[model samples]
Target chain A: MYAKRIITTMFLVTALVITLPKGVFANGHDLESLKNTVEQLKTQLDKVQIQLKAQEEKTAKKKDIRDLKQKIEQSSIRPVEFEINDSIVHLAGYSSVTFADNDGAGDRFNQVQFSPIFHYQYKDLMMLESELEFDIGLDGSTTVALEYLTLDLFLSDYLTVIAGKFLSPVGQFRQNLHPGWINKLPSAPPGFGHDGATPISDVGLQLRGALPPLGNVRTNYSFYVANGPELEAITEDGEVELEGIIAEGFTRDADGTRVYGGRIGVLPIPELEIGISGVVGKTEVTVLDGAAFGDEPSRRYRVWGADFAWKYKGMGLRGEYVRSTIGEVTASVAPAGAHWRSWYLQGAYQFLPTKWEGVVRYTDFDSPHASEDQKQWAAGVNYLFSSNVIAKFAYEFNEGRVGKSSNDDTALLQMSFGF
Target chain B: MKNYIHIKTALHAGVLILAFFLATAGAQAEKHPNEEGDSAQGAKLWAQTCSRCHNMRNPKEFRDELWVAIVTHMRVRAGLTGQDTRNILAFLQQSNSVARKSSFTKSSTTSESKGIAGIGVSSQDVLARGKTVFEETCVACHGDDGKGVVPGVPDFIDGNGVLSQSNEVLFNHIVNGFESPGSTLAMPPKGGNEDLSNKDIKDVIEYLNATFGS
Candidate 1:
């Protein structure tokens, strides 16, 4: 009887479930509405997060721009340059060519030259200046050489340290003057240009700067130390001959000794500059084959020099004097004491209206051992197309102390351009 | 001693040259316009005027003394006044230095315009309105010599007074009249006459530039 009651109760409950109302458990609309509400909440949260990310990114980008601007401003305070990676570089250039006629040597194309200048700078403290020149060689081939490759460390306005190959400070022409565009004439003073009396380049260290001005007058100085030149002694036809070979560029020291040199310049007025320079050093050379087969040791290549430059109105005047004393060679039987002297004077007048400049120069050189005295006079005119281009015509009259005045006269024409 | 007594003799000649230069240039040091010039203005003028005819030159092309003389020499041909000459010198000096320029372009341009401010006046247009009105009306106190006649008057040739002001400022000064507390004299409206029109003021500005700032 109990089992039968249990079975009846189960059947009654099952029937009650099947008979429930439609609204009691809610329709599909309510379930769909709840799902839409949840999806809407998720979309709103995503929008808010995206907006926040955009604001953060915008602030970061603005900071990056500000940093870039500050870096540019700081870099601009130094020498102007264009950046590549970690280095900054600048470009400059010079060039020249010439046609020459000589009484003894006949007419010929003298020389052609092109030079490019480069400057690389680091921060505001260090710098490198390089110049490469391509010149016509004796065999009519182009020869390349480094004019100067200097490294500079800026110490202050009053001091800068320079090293590597540098122009000699003993003569202003070798150091401060002689660019094709800057020089008014087609040629420089005799015995003062390349391969002349003074060595043009030195591998050395130098201190150079302009001193404090006195009134409106300006003053500058350069002090240097370098490997000195070489002096040679030879025996020919029972006579002792002495010679000085001035080689320039990066090279090993000939005598394994250093030279001390300095230049002091003063401008009493803005239009004039006066200077005194000197050098003291050791020089030694080995005689190839002679009565004495050993090296001829000469410790003294003492030099003294003076120069001046003045310009008034459109006229410019410049002059220089250099003297050298070579010590006696120790390996030769005869005492080979040699003294060398050179001097030149040049004047130029520029016609402002036509951009034309007329120049005249007189030069004299005395070489020891050869006992030769040479005198030269030159007259030239320059037609400048612009500041960077010039055409020059010049005539030179040369006379040795022993030869006729007309024996070695020459004429020259040249055009120069720079970018 | 060296055998070339000529070098010693030439040194004597060098001494003579030094003496002569000292005598000539001792008190004869030239006063350049660079000392008082506004370099910013000069650079702008150089870019605007000089670049019209040719490419620009590097300041390292000449020494300061040579640059001064060159600028002064060209002034006569170019018709630039003392003020413009000085400004050019200042620009060159700052440009030539390896270090940063001591005097930078002003951080804020007090009188500069934002965009294409000045009218595009061609050479012919400027020449048409050249110094006729200036000669007839402005030459009395301004002087026929081009310098200012009065002590406090505007020196058009030297970039003084109205010449120093911008085009808009100068125009307003002329149109509305000007009287400064520091100055005793007063500039009448429309340049003290009934003949000057608004176009006349433009002509005078062109005349000033052509005569003194070219």
Candidate 2:
């Protein structure tokens, strides 16, 4: 038993020595000293055991101590079952209920919106992020949909390869600052949100990254090839023609053709970014009326825009202009063959003395070949309780140069929160 | 022919002027307000100390410049030092600074060093070596999760733990040992690992701060 104890002690000591860094030994003879110390400890332990046996005449304390030591030893020697800590999951989202009163049109509180974002990181190389939006109104109408699902693969310091459905990398508002918590205004500028002139997202692969700073300027860029927007037959207003943005986010290809989109931006300074973006796709459309009623061969749809943002101190100013066009679809019925334009400019200021930020914006949309364009002017203020919670109030004036409005103006009150 | 030369020269000068303006503007926006303090420490401080009274925030809650101004205002209220304030700024910028990209010009390129302007990776070697020291020495007392196994050992997983002590305090105590009037059991210098160099200790400290920080 004594020999066996010596063997086991030497083995454990050797294992410990091998595991530690080579530099951890204080002296050349440290190993020898350790062996001698262990031997002396053994002798002293035996002496103490005898003394305890004579004094207490019981092994309760000794057994308890031995059991504890044994447990520690066992735990220490077992293999570490390390959980795969390569990923960090963050759950961030927002909920908002907005009340709007449209001019001339009866006003009512719309839906309660709950959008939840799941951002997951797999080590340093991959990211899987998605957001789901749910809208439930007091009238019992409900809508639920996946807003976007993006998979990003970090290829290099300067570039990332991305796949899956992602926000159109074309403009400032669509790809960034579109989240409810991040958006300063309660509603997107006229002609810019979900029903905007340009498509907001597509399904495809993309490459994006930052470039080395140029002197004092910094630049970032993105390029994508995706299942592009297709011309859809618009049935509204008793119209039957391939129209724009009707099937904008369709993931499946209609004519075995893909669309190309890209954006390039440069920071003229830390406070400002100027960028240009464009997308091109092809689709077939057959207008049953309005001029060319026959099946039109596949035609190319093109969109291009410029956006800029300048922010300093507590003031932010931004604007964007987008133009979309289609090849000879129709002159009367399918106006997409003509030209359409959308543009907006906004300014926001934070009165630091108070937690209130005031904003003013003007947006205009010109339909294809329309004699009159639609325009809106808006102003609002946000009282921030914290970074994640805010209360907002806004009013907007809308007018059509040629058309009629069920609501000529609107006002809104909103409260939004996120975690 | 002479007219063509004049036109070419004028256009070249215009391009140069635009480039110069862009560079100058970029510098204005990319200015690092302060270069002191470490971001890891700032994250820990923000997570543990500031969140004590208020809730934690996502980095995207404010702009980078706004964050700097807010930190400056709160420094006096919170009684934080200059280093602490700067570290917090760095943390906020790295965590939440909105990335800016160059506008599209070229189609694509396969090249080295094409990356995000403000993003960077830390030295892997130092972190790797530091992790070795931690496993060999630190795990014995401050167990795998930096939770204390003994009565006197302090927990390092939570905020304000032994590891979160100011760098100065950690340096002094770790270099020496826990020596105070009311101390029950004192930790040994270098956690009783006599062979550890000052660099080894520093590396381990950095590893702990980076890995377990907020």
Candidate 3:
């Protein structure tokens, strides 16, 4: 009790001292006031304590004393639970509703999704995180999708490394973060959506860090390898097989590709951020020899792309241009041809700092081999009720076509919440 | 002689280190505000410094209006007199702005440091709401001040150690009533009053933010 009183008095004195005039301490006027307040308050406290003690002695009951002792014991004992100091672990979930339309027949899909993220942190060095997503967009089924699970190692004050399933370091948006359903312009960059063939998440390892080198800014870089997925090529007989083997000890080097990519970014000012990135790699494919001969060897595929992003205050501007090459297709099969280019220009403006945000963007993709181009536009708004909870609504219009004659259009709305 | 001198030097360093730690510990101790500091004491302070020009209503009435008025009033008050009536307004605007202004000496600490997390919440509002909840339901002994005026009336603010709990714990206390003997005060559901939403209890807990949690 004496210790507690002394500490409280000291804090009160310091606070009083700060509130005093510039030379009040030197003039002794401040100390005088503090002394007066302390004396008066202490005298009053003593009287109250005496009165309380007298009352307690007069009406002391054995049951009451026993109860008081028990209460203190319960309150003083800490609960046994996993805790990182005072910070507690919590389960966070994010999801959004999207309505999409494509200019064509009724091939457009509209749906809602829930992506739950579990994150655990220990001070500044380590964090364990995993995400699970439920999508009703494709086939309208709830499939258990492993988003990413990783143990992030903060290697230095400015750098970090991760060895686990994580995003492929392909572009600024694709690697470190994803555009929110509402924060993105009407349409995402051409090759980023669900139907796009580019990879969003990869099972691999990555080393990324920032350097406050020359210039009036901090720059960053990332290197990563993507664990490719299994894909098949159709044969004359409509059969699918592994794509790289041809005969005894014969192969095409078309096995699953390892994705390699890096990014460079600069924080010119506290509120302004800019970054650019690119990735290249060959992905495996199962090819068909013919219906009579069955499926034969695989084919090595290559994909490469670049992107740039900028954010200032509540406004953001982002764009990415990518080209992928799928080398050889089949024996006499027409070549998959030139670079398949995809790009988009997007911008967002938040109403109040980061609480409510608005976005609009346009995207288009032209396949080197395909006859048609896919294009889209999106506009949306997001409302952040708190730091952890948010509501978003967006409308997207999509179009896919070769000439002006045959094209597809789509629209959507989304709301997501996560910490 | 050289070895002895080295040992002496090491001893001197250790003593200096120990003294530094002691001083810091003492400083920290002096800074911790007591949870059980009398509300009447706060009320007295409020009356003397605050009541002079402003109206004294139930804290609920002053909730929204008081903040804009207080923040603007405090600057002029600071310029003119003592402490600018700075009485742990943690309960008023949950964000500790005054504390930040005191600690952040550097000019470049962006507005990002002043998060909206603790904005617009005050302890008095929480206490007033907590008291109302306790009263509408706990009429028998735990009287208005949350100090249980009668025998067995668990003083929510003091002796019962309720005020020492985190907002969440206090929330559970008021939500899930005490069923055991030492906790005989039996906090009915929402302190017996079913009308108060869980949000009400959260506000009360936010009021107690300075009490239980750092």
Candidate 4:
């Protein structure tokens, strides 16, 4: 049934490609040609399978192994295969969920989300990928968002350029997915705000390339503009600092803000990867103008972080730290604190060798009083259905301090498909 | 106590030297030799000897250390004992190292080698024999399309000078399994069957050459 579904999907996609606008189709003719080739191969395979099935029935119990061999030869008299280059654009995705129980609170399911993605490539180069997410249940925030749209230009075997909105490449977990439903000892890393701002996506450009000496070194960097928090300058007290400022209405709200960041990573060995990433930019915030809404102010924010990851023989360990500071220069707005820091540590193991991966992560933030400012512990497992899709389930335990001290526990289940 | 101290110091020094040698060997071992290994023989050995358990391992998977381990393991698996295994190991390590080092050099030397069997297998009778050998041994994994089913199975379509490998290199892998860690499966000795002679494997290599390209 699954094979039938896959075949039907391929046929529909092939037909869709044929009817696409010529301009769009022409741009990706290489992809179209590869798709056609795969389709043709599938057709030939189906025919061969049908013949093989018929022969199997004919041979039945009285069939001699030698006679079966001769039957195979007779079947082989016809072309079992056609032209050969094996290439195609694959589409896939995956999702995860978790349930948890804190110290004394009632056990509950925490977060659940789905990330559906599409990937295109041939020969492992000239690739494009995009991820979309829709979250509900457990945490139950019903909305859809674009996760990342990356166009990778592999310049050479070792050099590549990625452009578009993507995970800021900040901390390890910011780019890495959740292991299961549990948070490790220290889950939240620095720079990520109380609302867990680490998975920040922005429209920007990046260049990722490797250094010489092949396996010794590699680096990734990016520059982008994205939606960010507002920053306004406040006096010693909580008053806005707008002494000698000319308010220009030239900035359009839709124009958004500018975000610039870069990440440089290195892999000393094939198993160990480490990197430092930083982002600095301005965000727009609105103020009340004597009971009326004021213009959006450009708030300056900076986030810097470092991460280390070791993956060898199915044992994976990763840790990251980030520090974020926001200073608002807008007049009349109160100045917030200097900086808020967060950090986390995580570890995972593949119990079923390379088939199933289990993860544990822990995160803590300074302001544990806010709804989103609690320490999180989560654990989960991922079952790889194939190289591309996976089924995941996890549990999270969140303890809130300083404020109301409500415990948020969650159970999440998700299925993600990707290319 | 005095003797123990001396032994400990010597052991420390020995450890240090071995560590340095292994590290340096790992770091600097990428200088590849000229294309000298028999890829055809390697393929046959892969089908005959290696395929008994696992699929054919593509040589391009490893850098150096892993390749060394894998090829050495295969030597033992092929029942080459010790000395035979070592010889075969030398051939594989030399060939794989050359492929890697050339890819990274100031200029790539991969294309410099001549196409395999530029002279041999040109005769019709020789081509016919080579074809038969291939049908009997190589046709399964390599497939009729010449695009093998498993990943890492190098397509014969555009492989440069793959068939043109030196007979010695071919014989080494054919007689001994590929020992690279990157190889998921070793090419068994003498294409695993042990029935064919070194010359038989050579004929198939020639057939691969004649069938794929000019």
Error of 1 at A398 (Å): 0.8
DockQ metric, candidate 4: 0.02
| DockQ of predicted candidate 3 | 0.01
lDDT of 4 by residue, A127-198 (tens): 566777777744455777676777764443233446666565666565543322222212233235223435
After superposition, which runs of candidate 4 have C-alpha atoms over 4 Å from their true positions? A1-87, A97-112, A122-126, A137-142, A178-194, A197-199, A218-257, A286-294, A330-332, A350-360, A367-372, A376-399, A402-419, B1-214
Candidate DockQ scores, in order: 0.03, 0.03, 0.01, 0.02
Clashes of each: 1, 15, 42, 84
* Model 1 C-alpha lDDT per residue in residues A1-419, reported as the tens digit of each score: 44654465455445544575556349788657645654575466456656877887777577798999999988766443221223445666678898888776778888899888777755334567778989988798999989888886544434456788987888667764566766666777767776467768788777665555567566677777776665555567888666544636436676666777878878675556788999887766544443223444555678899988775444667889988777775564446777778899888776643467788999997777443567889999987676568798998887774454333778989888766
Determine which window of 10 residues in candidate 3 chain B has minimal summed lDDT: B75-84
Q: Candidate 3: where are CA atoms >4 Å away?
A: A1-90, A100-109, A122-124, A137-140, A176-182, A185-187, A195-197, A212-215, A229-257, A287-303, A329-338, A352-357, A368-372, A381-393, A402-406, B1-214
lDDT of 2 by residue, B14-113 (tens): 6446434443432322122344545655654453334322223655565554555456433422334344556677666655532222231111231112
User: Residue B84's C-alpha lDDT in candidate 3?
Assistant: 19
What docking class should model 3 receive? incorrect
The alpha-carbon lDDT assigned to residue B2 of candidate 1 equals 60
Calculate candidate 3's fnat: 0.00
TM-score of 1: 0.57
Task: Give Cα-based local distance difference scores for all models.
Answer: 0.62, 0.62, 0.46, 0.49
Candidate with best lDDT? 2
Pairs with backbone N, CA or C atoms under 3 Å apart (clashes), candidate 1: B33-B86
